[model samples]
Target: MQPLLIYNTLSHQKELFKPLTPDHVGMYVCGPTVYGDGHLGHARPAITFDVVFRYLRHIGYKVRYVRNITDVGHLEHDADEGEDKIAKKARLEQLEPMEVAQYYTNRYHAAMDALNVLRPSIEPHASGHILEQIELVQKIIDAGYAYVSNGSVYFDVRKYQEDTKKYGCLSGRVIDEMLSTTRELDGQEEKHFSGDFALWKKAAPEHIMRWNSPWSVGFPGWHTECTAMGTKYLGETFDIHGGGMDLMFPHHESEIAQQTAVCGHGPCKYWMHNNMITINGQKMGKSLGNFITLDEFFTGKHELLDQAYTPMTIRFFILQAHYRSTVDFSNEALIAAEKGYARLMQAYKTLGRLQPSKTSSVDVKEYRQKCYDAMNDDFNTPIVISHLFDMAKVINTVNDKKATLTQADIDELKGVMDTFVFEIMGLRDEASSDNTALIDGLMKMILDIRATAKANKDWATSDKIRDELGTLGVTVKDGKDGATYEL
Candidate 1:
């Protein structure tokens, strides 16, 4: 088996992945904030890491994947300057903060389910881990890398840089440049330096998500939640930490700083980040006002969408690009993806019904190793998909009676398709799941009737049945064995 080589954002190169503990892997990914509906931006990281989780398990590793939910302390500006995003929504709607969080959280889960994103092993809410966050903040303060001011505590970025000289190691930021250009924000006047971020913020009088801590009645900062929750669930140092490329600057950089301050080392061995989904070459995000929610994409309710797309189509679209590459969305792109998904599923069905010949005319055994090679190369999904499409063409040729494969080759091709197409890539046949049994029975009966018509030499009745079914978006084909239908 080829060793997995993943690109580490910290090292800026692909490195061989070796787990800390034998046969076990720990991965932590930054999950949704849950103040609003999940968008294309949110789906990128969720689906990207879900593949990582699936492949790790599929390769015989005991994987504990932790994805955190930021239910509180995520402010309007991701820094400590603005209103809490969830609390602001709750105030606007005149509801409790947790009510808003739970409502949107449920919606996020629903969208993820529709996208076929597998749920993480542990989904920790920031609100549920206040004590751990407070303890982490205390550790930073005790280590002299943080300070208390005005009932709130802030990480001392200047002190951390002065001591360790590694404050921006992951982000490649120069401390001098950051200190010179950093914008001063509200409630940050008490900080020792403008670049220092909040560990815990003292709750304002109107803040809805307040918790008791040594500094004040407050909540954990946006950066502290992941550090605390990840450490609590996956230990101080895990195998992989992943999120979006947009978070490389302050979010993940701060996570490294906090963990270094506490444990004298960074949190993870390898840091992975998936690139963003863009609209017309611009990043699609809630803050950008250009994001189309997953629901909008599904229903074609958004102004930008040309047609409604299924869950599997969306999943296939994302998988068509490498996780590290920016995928720009357009109507033409998604329509192409939908057609490609349909063909892939059709080829899979054809593979299942293929008859083995006495001898082989094509070699099908190499596809399995080829797929494993693609997966081993930093989870390069597009290459894997290209290989699958190549095999799909072969399957089509064989179905057309233009090629033949022995039983062993046929079984190997089936295993390759099943393992890579459905298992690792995480695509399902939407048609198979959407009342397929009923449709299969109906198609069987209709085909049987058509067969009877042909057997009785009633050409008019058979032709009428075939033409009417074709008008209803079903194609009927007559073969030597029997008649088959495609919907």
Candidate 2:
């Protein structure tokens, strides 16, 4: 078997994956803010890391995957300036902040479930870990890397940079350039340097979500949540930390600084980031008007969609591209993905009904190894998909009586397809065989009733049944022997 080589964004290269402990992995990925409906952007990271979680477990590793829910502390602007996103939503909707968070969090989970994304082993909410974040702030203060500014506490980027000279290592940003180029926000007057970020923000009297901390009545800064929660759950250093590429700069860079300041080292061994889903080459996000919610895609309610696309089609569309590559959304692209998914599923179905022969004409074992190779090379999903397509061709050819496979070879092919397509890649037949059988039985009964109506010359009843079935997107065909339905 090829050794798994994951691309570490920190190292900027693919490295052999070696868990801190044998056969155990601790991975953390930044999850949604949950202030609004989960859009196409949210789906990318959830599906990407879900595959990582799935593959690690499949390969005999016990993985602890922690994805945080940012219910609070994330400001309207990504920087520490604007109103809290959840709080703003709460105010607009005339509900408690937690109510807004809970509603959106539930919606996010539903969207992820529809995409077949597995739930994380641990999902810690930032609002729930106030003490942990406060302690983290104090640690940075004790380390002399952060300082109290008025009632708020700010991480002293200049001091940290001067002491360790490692402030921008993860993001490859020079501290000097950052300080000079940093924009002036409303609270910039309190910071020693423009580049300094908030560790704790002193809440105004009107701030809905405020906690009584050692400094003041305040809330943890946006970056403080992940640092505190990750350390508490994954220990000082863990195997992997992942999120979208958009977080690489301020958010992830700040994480590195905070962890390095307190622990004298960074948080994780590897940093992984999946690229964005874009519209007209612009990043799709809640802040951006172009984002289409997962619900919109499923219902075809959005102006951009021509027809409703199933959840499986969306998942297949994401997997057809490498995680590190940008995916530009288009109606044409999605339609093509739907067709490709159908072809793949059809081939899998054909493989099950294939007959075994005494003589084998094609090699089956090599494809299994080729798939392993693709996955090992930084989870190259596009290549793995291509290999699966080739395997599907072989399955189609064998089914067409153009090639033969021994029973052993046939079994091997089945195992390979099952492991890669379902177990590892996490794709399932949308039309489950059991469900199909049930639908078939119901349709048969309905058609039988319709036939009796026609036989009895009850033209009104027969026409009504036919028209109703048509409305439901089912067509009834009268054949020589009986009636059959197409859905």
Query: How well does candidate 2 score on lDDT at residue 433?
Result: 36
- In candidate 2, stretches whose alpha carbon ends up further than 4 angstroms from where it belongs are 76-82, 285-288, 433-487
TM-score, candidate number 2: 0.88
Q: For model 2, which pairs clash?
A: none
Looking at model 1, the pairs that clash are none
Candidate 1 achieves a global lDDT of 0.89
lDDT of 2 by residue, 1-487 (tens): 9999999988899999999989999999999998889888888899889888988898899999999999874753435455776777688899999999898999899889888899999999999999999999999999999999888999999888888888878888998788678777788888888888899988877689999999999898889899999999999999999999889888999999999999999999999999988876776755667778899999999876889988889999999999999998888999999999989899989988999999999988799899889988988878989998998999999999999998898889889889888888888889773387888899989999999999999999999999999999799888999888897
Candidate 1, run of 10 with poorest lDDT: 73-82
lDDT tens readout by residue for model 1, 1-487: 7899999999999999999999999999999988888888899999999999999999999999999888984853435466887888899999999998898899999889988889999999999989998999999999988999999898999888888898889889988888787776787688878888888888888898899998899788889989999998899999999999888888999999999999999999999999988897786765776789889999999877889998888899999999999999888999999999999999999988888899889887788888888899999999999999999999999989999988888888888888888888889988878997898999999889888998899999999999999998799988888988887
Q: Clashes in each model (backbone N, CA, C under 3 Å)?
A: 0, 0
Q: How far does residue 149 in candidate 2 sit from its true spot (Å)?
A: 1.0
User: How accurate locally is residue 411 in candidate 2, as Cα lDDT from 0 to 100?
Assistant: 86
